[model samples]
Target: MWPRMDGIRVLELGTPGELRTELTELTLSGAKTATAGLPALDYDAEREAVEHVGERLVLVDDSGMRAGEVEVTRVELVPFGEVGWEFARAEGEGYTSVGHWRESHRRYWEGQGCEVGDDTTIVCLWFRLV
Candidate 1:
């Protein structure tokens, strides 16, 4: 199970290293207001509920320390191929295009041992720092 702070779920971005640090910084700087997750692996597999609108979460740093707070503004189950440019850009990863985001995500998910395809469901979660 994942850790919780004061009963609020902890939001950890990427992994506990450079990726997490970069993502955390982006969120704190207001450059990132959204993120993507694999529902099957992140929610179902972990027995955690999907983030909903108005849900508050504690943002954690690479060391699992609370860095800030965020409130979910939207949640959508979008097909991998159906992800739009707006959401991709909101990720604040500086992707030049949707194709770039798709390819990068494909490689990341595949590296995590998941067989990703166009039909895979992606949890498009939007949040605002609080």
Candidate 2:
């Protein structure tokens, strides 16, 4: 299970390293308004529920320090291949296209031992810094 600060769920992006730092910085700067995850690997395996609209969460850094707070605005379950450019751009990771996003995400998930294919279910979450 993920950690909570002050009774709110924590949003820790990626692993504890450079990637996490970069992503957290983007989030804090309001550049990142969305994120994606594998429901099976991230939620079911971890026994956590998918975030709901209007839910408030604590954004945390690599060291588990609270960077800020965010409120969920939207959530959708989309197939990996069906994820679109709008969502990709909302990630604020400089993805040139949906293909680029898919490739990068595929590699990331596969590196973490999660099998990712075109049909893999992806949880697309949109949030705003609060």
Candidate 3:
């Protein structure tokens, strides 16, 4: 009943490829309880949705299918260079250290046409699979 595998789906959180696949898998496996995004997205309306706790999001795969779902449990704004290790660990990206997270995020942000710096504000979201 979650994916439906047919019609009217949920908000697609990730892009159309590897990142999406990895994130959805992580969510399904319950390893990933958190995610982060820039508040400067053009289509996200200043990323205000995270302000509401308990909001549900359906994870969509690159093939435009529902992969999983999650609910927002906590939200915080942290500097790109200041994201704590606890949060990084929760991302389930196998980051050995905060420095690794920063570099990986920096690469991802660059791919999105954004230049990441030490002071960049990142929306950190903690969620629960449901």
lDDT of 2 by residue, 22-109 (tens): 9999998888999999987789998999999999999998988889899999999999999999999999999999999999999999
- TM-score against truth, every candidate: 0.98, 0.98, 0.83
CA RMSD of each candidate after superposition: 0.7, 0.7, 4.2
Instruction: Please write out the lDDT profile of model 3 over residues 39-106, one tens digit for every residue.
Output: 77622554334444777776677787667767789988888888999999999989999999888988
Candidate 3, which segments miss by more than 4 Å at Cα? 1-13, 42-48
Itemize residue pairs with steric clashes in candidate 3: none
In angstroms, the error of model 3 at 68 is 2.1
Sort by lDDT, best first: what order?
2, 1, 3
Candidate 3 lands at a TM-score of 0.83
Q: Show the colliding residue pairs in model 2.
A: none
* Candidate 2 accuracy as TM-score: 0.98
When summed lDDT is taken over every stretch of 10 residues in candidate 2, the lowest stretch is 1-10
lDDT of 3 at 2: 27
Q: What lDDT does each candidate get?
A: 0.93, 0.94, 0.76
